[model samples]
Target: MVIPIFLPHLGCRDRCTYCHQGYITDVSGEDIKARIDAAFIHRAAPCDVGLFGGNIFGIEPAVLEKMFSFFEPYRDWVRAFRLSTKPVPLRDETIYLLKENKTDIIELGIPTFNDAILAGLNRAHTGQDLFDAYHRLQEEGFSVALQFMVGLPGENENDIENIIRNMVRLKPVYIRIYPLVVLKDTPLYTLYRTGQFRPTAFDDVLDCACRIYANAVKNGISVANVGLTDNELVRDMVAGGHYHPAYGFLVQSRIFIRAVEIVLKHLGYPKDITIILHNADIPLLIGHKKQNIMKFSRMGVTVKWVPSGNNRGHFEVRSQKGSAAGSVQDIYDQ
Candidate 1:
């Protein structure tokens, strides 16, 4: 469940180049304080209260302390409290504050790890800032998450690799990848208007998503999210940046296809192929929208995503060349 609160959405000491404050935080004055004090503390909502919107701890330190104090009593009642903040908020003191408040999880909107891209995006911090914050939070025993964005202006495959490299160094408990998304009334929109910015292509972003997810899995890291949340209003408001309501699903489906491609290259199938996948990821490998299935069919691969009781997110691809199908033997040979 999502529990919303009003604060600086980006929550930096100052707004960055692509900040849209109003759209993110629609609360004002007493309403904001009241919600933080009441809804998350006194009032009964969902068990999970997300101290969300912008930077959760980005207010004045005093205000931050007050907000923390307000929720102290109810900390145990709630199963978990997720604090969303800027990467800099992972400083020594900030981690202590979160711990004191009994925060169960912490997430940073890192955006990108490439220093040049981050500077161009006006992220107000460097890749080191993320690493420092990440390490500090970990030493303090907090569940840490690092968020990265792809397909921003000045970002290419190298920039993407940089993100992966830096993030792997951090080894965050949760990793979220957001494709660059443009919104109205932001610096990015202005750049787009002047033709200085071009949104990443949908297919390109999908390919990147597959690599990123695969890398996380290879490293035994949990990819908490792959793309922006699916919402029609958000999609409609997206003026630029690899924005698609179905993009996340497509990315997941592509991951399955990528893995299947690897399997096929090894197995050498020349006919219709049936791929059975682990139950947990069946929806993703086949796609929630049957996107992967269609893509597979178009490529002359017939994938039948079935439950694999013995495995999760693992699949077997069967190449049907009638009775003469020789690919099955390749699986045994491997």
Candidate 2:
């Protein structure tokens, strides 16, 4: 069973320019309890429950006390509890309080650690604030996950590398990479409208993701999420900036591209080959916007994704009769 708890914009003191979540959730205590109870009946996730959204750290202590009370019934079944909050949420007293609550993990959205960029985004806390929170949380014995964004207005490309370097220095157990996604109805949208903000380009996003991917691989920190969860499929979405729901799969495919380079060396590479993956993973394997499949075709590789074996995450590629012959087993072996 996988149960994801989204409180969505509950306790934020500073409503970020891009935030619409303030209109999207139940901020009241009774609503929180009701939502949790309703979720239990249909939830399929294991005991792990994720707490996300609405300034989780900005709220009062009593809110959390009651919030935890709602979880007491599931404590035995719940193996872990995780939550995501702004990077500024990390305070010494907050650290002590979270420890007392037995939170297994705290995901801090550091967005970008660049001081100037932080101000540009109106991110209330500083890069120093993030590190302060991180160190305090570590000392108190909690697993930390840092979430970062790339390509904010006024930030240079080098800032991406710096963010990665800082995270490596921090040595968190988990991380999430979100290229700057421009959402509407927020202050960012206004900035975008006024030409005050410019999103990172797609090519740059791919390039940055590649660099971050390599460093994450070397660092051994699990990249839990690599992109946006909701793509532009929603009708009401305001704007687009490297927004793709299947961003993780694209990053994985990019990783596979690296692997393909190695595999082609041994198996006379074909100009085109059809890659078959399980049907269940069509969204992830094909990519959020069919970008992966299309991109491969444009690169002169005939990649075709077909439904196959029940293995959820497994994939196999076949070359057309006249195209070439590379062992599917060989690719899988790699």
Candidate 3:
């Protein structure tokens, strides 16, 4: 379980082209303490406490220290202390302070590595800032996650490939991908209005995101997230772009389709085939609205998806003439 503590725009120095944090309701420090207290007092299981909504390090050291102190009494019950921040200069002392407070992971919102794209987004940090912060945090023995976005303004397929290559080189403990969404009162929205920037088509974005997800997972890096969260504020502010509550499912469904296609291609489109997958992946395999099943049907290929209580990613395909069992990598490699 994870308990999120939203410090909405609490330490923002500048706004990004997609953020509208000012419209979000604020949660006071007192309110945070009360929530934490209630979580521990009422809940029995261990839970991670996340400090989200803005850069935690950007807050004043004194106030941060005070906030960290609030978790001291419940330290034993806290499974993890995770926080997200922008790619900014981080002092060594601040790293040490986080360690002293038992912080577990630091997620950096790096978005994209392309300098031109970063500039277009008005992300006030250089690519070097990301490398510096990543190295510094790792050197301090803290797990770090590099957060990336899929459809930032000016980003393309080549940009996505480059970002994946760079992220693999960094080898962060976790990676998150947020497909861009044009929100109200942001620079991106202005650009959209002027026809200066166009959001990537949702299907195109889903395909691109699936490529990144497959490559990243194959590299042994955890793709912690695939899309943005849906909420009242997001719904109210979203003007366009890939904003879907079930975005992760959509990406996985695409992946499932690809994996199945690869297998079928290799097997010479047998008359009938049974694809055995883990039970948990049933919905993804069938796809949203049974799209995959229907697609196979339209191709005149008899496809059956069977669930087995086995390891995820481990699957088997059986046809009248042949049978094979392998993981996604096996099929993808073909």
Candidate 4:
């Protein structure tokens, strides 16, 4: 488990076009100490601590040192430290401080490798910066995770390919995929209001996210998360872009549906079939709102599912004519 301490926009020099951390997180930078204290109160087990919601590397070494000092008293309860930030301004001093403070993982937010898009988002860093930071962090014996965004302004299929290529090459410890969401009062919101930045089709964005996620899993990289966590504040602030409360579920269900479609095709589109899968994956197979079931109905295939002790992601489809067993991994392998 990880205890999150949100320092929203604390170390950021300038807000990105889509950032409005105040709406995404309730805790302010000023509440760091109090938040930390509250989180550790009545703690019964050591847990990892996550410093989130700011460009941690952008903070001065002195400020970072002091900020880490807040956790000194509860250091015994912290198994390790992790933080997320933009992958630039990674000063050697900051690196040393992070290592000295027992920070084991650094999650770099690389929205896209497209230079033009990066500049348009006011990220103030390029793809080269991420490569530099990633290499440096790895050399320092730090495990790295990546956070990627989809459906950004100016993003296209090429950009998505770039993301997959880099992710496969770097092979981070894990990854989180987020579809961009325009928040209220942000620069991106202004663009949306003026009709200058219309988001891509929702299904298109979801499909692209599935491709990224599938690539990550196929490459043996764990997907730490997919999509943003829904909250009242975020729900209230969303102006446009791909935002959904069950966004992650939608991605997983899409992958399941795709895998089933491939298996059915290989079986010559059997009219009726029963899928035996691990009980844990029933939700994924059924999908949100039973959409997958309805989709199968439209395709002239009758679907039935049975729970089994079969390993997760493993499914067997049976029909009168034939039987085939496959896993989600089959989707990427083909």
Best by TM-score: 4
- lDDT to native, each model: 0.67, 0.69, 0.80, 0.91
Q: Write the per-residue lDDT of candidate 3 for residues 165-268, one digit (tens) a residue.
A: 88779898988888898888988899998998888778888877887787777888898888878788788888898999888888888787777777777777
lDDT of 1 by residue, 1-334 (tens): 6565546563556566665655644344455566666764555654766776577546656556766666556665566668777776444455566676667778878877778878888777787887777776777777888777777777788777776776666677878887777878788889988998877677787677667766776666788877767766566667877777766667666666666666776666545666565566767766756777787778777655446553655666666542121111122110
Using lDDT as the measure, the top candidate is 4
TM-scores for all predictions: 0.83, 0.76, 0.91, 0.96
Task: Name the Cα RMSD for model 1.
Answer: 4.6
Error of 1 at 291 (Å): 3.8
Question: After TM-score superposition, what is the CA distance of residue 97 in candidate 3 from its true location, in Å?
Answer: 1.6
How would you encode candidate 4's per-residue C-alpha lDDT over 233-303 as one tens digit per residue? 99999988999999999999999989988889999999999999999899999899999999999999998
Ranking the candidates on lDDT from highest down gives 4, 3, 2, 1
Per-residue lDDT of 74 in model 3: 88
lDDT of 2: 0.69
TM match of model 2 to true structure: 0.76
Q: How accurate is candidate 1 locally (lDDT)?
A: 0.67
Local error of candidate 2 at 179, Å?
2.1
Model 4 bad stretches (over 4 Å): 23-30, 332-334
